[model samples]
Target: MSLTRRGFLVGLPLLLAACSTRTTTTSTVSMISAYGPIADDRFPLPGLNARLIQPHLRRQEVDYESSHAKGSLVVDTPNKYLYYILGNNRAIRYGVGVGREGLALRGNAYVGRKAEWPSWTPTPNMLRRDPEANGPYRNGVPGGPNNPLGARALYLYRNGNDTMFRIHGTNQPQSIGLAMSSGCIRMLNHDIIDLYERVSSGARVLVIQA
Candidate 1:
């Protein structure tokens, strides 16, 4: 099931109210502290080299004034920013690599599922566009450090149908803030792992395209 723009707008208020009432016992400060510099052998994510990325593209907490309810995920395409609303006019912002011009998606969706080290299968359309690049992955690529989908994935859905779009980690950390994907939004592997742990399945996401 997919929702039209009108349908999503109609339900927006109700969704916001429901999300506002939910709260975690943990403090936002502590939560930020917990997500400290990512270092774990289990996933083997290499530390991000600051010199490789611009200062603005790095993950950081910022003062975000928005009408969206707490816990909602907002993607500002033009700014290359993804914000997780933390209430109190604050948000945890992560830099993202968005879809190249013609492939971008906008409007509302919810995270229908989540995965760790998710598999990647190139769609038929993707394979057709770049056979040499995507054809071999038609059967799917096993998840790992080198896989394009990286360490975590949050699958987006609208009206219960898979959008075939995702907020997932990428093997190429330097791609953050660039418009260079088929459609999926890409995050740093470390950042995605942190976001995956914080966001719940079914959380609302709003994408603003400019």
Candidate 2:
């Protein structure tokens, strides 16, 4: 039942073709099932509309051969895929929305901290560039389903300094696979919660831009 990265890549087209025939109800059920259950105290996350996301962007396990040790987070930015290395040449991949145009960054960082339903504040530079979009958040926005930073956030740091970047959930699930954020890596609410549970503080994160 398991496939290697090469096998997965080779068979992906056929797999997607099979999935295309699944009933809407079946797809909905599968999507909901992927999320398991939510805790009562947590913010309610909406079900992802499968139509809004590309097939490759959906969360799945695949054979991933990586030089990084198991448990490291590797982000293939150009491909818009984030891989949580599981060793044995395997990983759990999730679709992501990354920085658009000039906001992208290339570097190595670590998860300095993490938060569930974390508050968000716009950086001074962000405010200066587009006050209308980043202005209201000057005082910080409380975490919620409607918040831009969706369900969870993994703050990225480098050499003990905050990089001010994040691997966070997005309110805009449709944005998955697009380069459309200020700089933070954005994931679906369901995807992020899964990642948040798996990632720990100080986990190595490699952002491969090429």
Name the regions of candidate 1 deviating beyond 4 angstroms: 1-41
lDDT (Cα, tens digit) per residue for candidate 1, span 1-210: 111100100001111211221222323343334333445535665445444555555555565667888888998887787888878876767779999998877999999999999989987779988999898788999988878998899999999999999999998877889999999999977678778877899999999887
**Model 2 vs. true fold: TM:** 0.83
Summing lDDT over every window of 10 consecutive residues in candidate 2, give the lowest-scoring window: 16-25
Over the stretch 4-89, how does candidate 2's per-residue lDDT look in tens digits?
21111111221221111111112444444554445543776544455456667777666565567888898878878888877776
Best candidate, lDDT? 2
Report residue 13 deviation for candidate 2 (angstroms): 7.0
RMSD of 2: 6.8
TM-score of 1: 0.81
Considering every candidate listed, which one attains the maximal TM-score?
2
> Candidate 2: misplaced stretches above 4 Å?
1-32, 35-41
